[model samples]
Target: MFVLELGLIGLCVALLPLSYVWVKASDDKFRKLVWMTTFLTLDLVMFGGFTRLTDSGLGCPDWPGCYGTASPFVAHAQIAAAHAALPSGPVSMTKAWIEMIHRYFAMAIGVLIVAQTAIAWRARFKRLPLHVSPWWPTALLMLIGVQGAFGAWTVTMKLQPIIVTTHLLLGLALLGTLGWLAARLTPIPVYEPQISRYRFAAAVGLALLIVQIALGGWVSTNYAVLACTDFPTCNGQWIPPMDFAHGFHLWRALGMTADGDVITQDALVAIHWTHRTFAFAVIAYLVALALRLRGYESLRRPANSVLLVLAIQFATGLSNIVLQWPLPIAVAHNGGAAVLLLLVVMLNFRTASSRPGRAAVPTRDAAPA
Candidate 1:
């Protein structure tokens, strides 16, 4: 009963965007829908970060529903009981609402993807010469399903560090994929054959970005953001004591070692230090890549976007340490990562799509009749 109600809530939330796209998009509705979905997905990823940071992950202490019910209102008694039992614990009215809102938003995104898949297949059956292939949305649908599974595991597994980190990775993966789909649907204005030369560099930059995001996720999941209270140098020393062995252990409870010992400060420092040091290398490589891409007219916009978001990421990341991990700054830092990933994925798509021998895909100027 609660499952059905939860689905209905998701449907209601999804209808807002679906109706807007249907009514407002005069042409290329499919493309508009995909882009809208991508935009909302980026929002969802950031909100997921908020949910985690607020300690609302276990707000309901269950999967898919709050206290086995649809709305947090229906589960208020249970939530109140838990909060009364432990006022500072993970369960509270506010946290429960936050968690449920996040869930509702995620389900709404899932519904939108389903609509994309359905509309795409319908066009395929009618033999419409759509700019994007139906298989792209189909693949997105599959990826979202895997993402949903990870979401469930993140709750059921008690926010185990690895599972939670993987959940974050999957969310970003979905965001990147949707960005790729949007790029495919909306054709680049100027196709410079030379743009293809940067394809390898863009790919390498994206790969490095993913690794850095994963490291960041590990730090967040383990609550290691403040392990080093200083920037450039950690804890007043350039080389801090760290326990890489316990910090990198994959299959342990949150803040626990494989041997059931409470995790040490050294382990937390290792997680934070590794993420921090590797960030320098990733940033340098990406900034260099963006600078190279900026010389080309066709790649200039996304390259500029990369540079802008990278600056925000750097600023917010520093503030996270210096400001003692304020919630809004932390959330912005996560959002900056998503925006950077989207920009890089767009850069990759532009470079690949402009290759010399490829069949000329429809540009915005040349829509299919």
Candidate 2:
């Protein structure tokens, strides 16, 4: 089984040659590869959310494959049996496909990261406009390896809430790492002017945004989105009876409270309510960060990015509650959270990319050119 799985991963890795050849003629090959990985990571996060939302997380019911087989081919008989037994349970033909596809995308990303690590070190000794620290890709390769471990645990642990939530957090962390590396290695932007004067504030926003994402992940993993079933106020009340102790317990079984009791309605309400309330504060702070960047020409693009994604995030979030947890909107809401995250990471990277000896990127003076 393990050998077959390794071959599957190798098959995905084989595609990297095509991508590398396409970028081989470029002046900066590693830079393009890192950006491509970032793009795919964003999509992976979205599709992973889709799998969770559609209840396909346990589709395969095993780590890395569907019933000990690579493409769901050999597992057909077992999957059909399970679905027939439960009828509407987690395992199904369509769902197994979703899970496997998500895994394939993940393997492709892993392969690219490995290739990136090799290229960065190899190119360090060659002529280039900028020098990339081998540590950047080296560290990224390590992080993604850990991420792959969590992916396996996510299945073996049967989607335990804490385990699953941590898995999601790690995925976002990987995205941030790639974005930061790309910004550092990008020859053109390495010497560009810092976009935000409020670097300290942006850093704060990034930290707090991470906290907000953790809360959001908790909401999703616990399947608590519709607990309130109304927007602006939960269940049409300013305050609802909630069990925070049970809701916030970090370690527990899938649907059981920390005390091993079946989780209560009040606990679910608490999980949903805390996430909703905290989101307002996070949204406001991010908007402030975006507004501060509006004055800088170099920062305007990311500033607008912050605004646009935040708007979509708010819309999708509200629609999730009002629209009764529609799959498309929920998945898009997850994607919106990720976009908002990457924009902020990019903003931070831009502000910090000005190397010490190389003077800060010059700002556009108000005087006419």
Candidate 3:
């Protein structure tokens, strides 16, 4: 019964991309489908941030289906009763809706990926105009499936900090994949000579960015945003006391330290301060990489994009501190990080033409399409 309900909801959500594809029938259907899926995935990433920020991660209290049914309306009595008991806990009606909406968006992405996989397989055998290999979409299908599983674990695990943060990371990883694929489909000309050093630089920048993201995720999962309460100095000191042992311990329940004790304020500060201090190194290296690329005219666009998103990320990061983590700014900060990750992914993929070990990168603007 539960599985059937999930399928029903998936079917309902699938109508969106289905209808759009029908209305805009064109030669580039596969590419269009990929791009549409990419666009929706971007929204999903932002909304996922919204869900977490709003504390709606456990709104449904179950996976795939809300309270053993497809919609919150059907579970109104259960949700209301849970709310009446706790009132300000994780089971409110509004939160239920937020969580369920996030699921619907996810289901829609799944359906689109399935369609993409099937179409790519058919096109491969039939020798269609979209003469790309089927394996690409198939790989995306696999990645999205894993992502969905983490989504389920996010609920069943009762929003464990590690699980929730992994879910967030996986979502961003999926966004990067979709963005990279879409960039491949929309090939741009490269008039400037490819530099091996630039590719290496971008790769380093991406690696550092991922590490910073992980640290940031750790801070968010532990609810340490307000731990510092000041800029440049945490707790009004250059470095307040921090219990790194308890803070970096990974396998504890939410709000609990490694030894099953309530996590201390100092531990929270440790988490927050670590992420805060690391931002300097991340920014310095990425900006340097971007500046290096600016010397090449063709790489200037993505290079500038990297710098721009970097500034937005830094501003939002500070706003979260000074502004007390306002919802709009917080969510946008999450989105900005995802965008930065996406930009770096594109930079790495597109610049592969110069990477010594990489296969020949695809480009449609060789002579100009």
The lDDT leader among the candidates is 1
The weakest ten consecutive residues by lDDT in model 3 span 360-369
Which residue runs does candidate 1 get wrong by more than 4 Å? Answer: 363-369
lDDT against true structure, model 3: 0.84
Tens-digit per-residue lDDT, 1-369, candidate 1: 999999999999999999888887367777788899999999999999999999999998998999899988999899999999999999999999999999999999999999988777776788776766778888888988898899999999999999999999989999999998888777677778987888898899999999999999999999999999997899999989999999999999998999999999999999999999999999999999999999888789999999999999999999999999999999999999999999999989888877877524564321122
Error of 3 at 29 (Å): 2.0
lDDT for each candidate structure: 0.90, 0.82, 0.84
Candidate 1 residue 100 C-alpha distance from true site, Å: 0.4
What shift in Å separates residue 49 of candidate 2 from its native position after superposition? 0.6
Q: Taking the tens digit of each residue's C-alpha lDDT, what string does model 3 give over 52-99?
A: 999999999998888988889999999999999999899999999999
Model 2 quality (TM-score): 0.91
TM-score of each: 0.97, 0.91, 0.93
Query: How high a TM-score does candidate 1 get?
Result: 0.97
Candidate 1 residue pairs in clash (backbone atoms < 3 Å): none
Candidate achieving the largest TM-score: 1
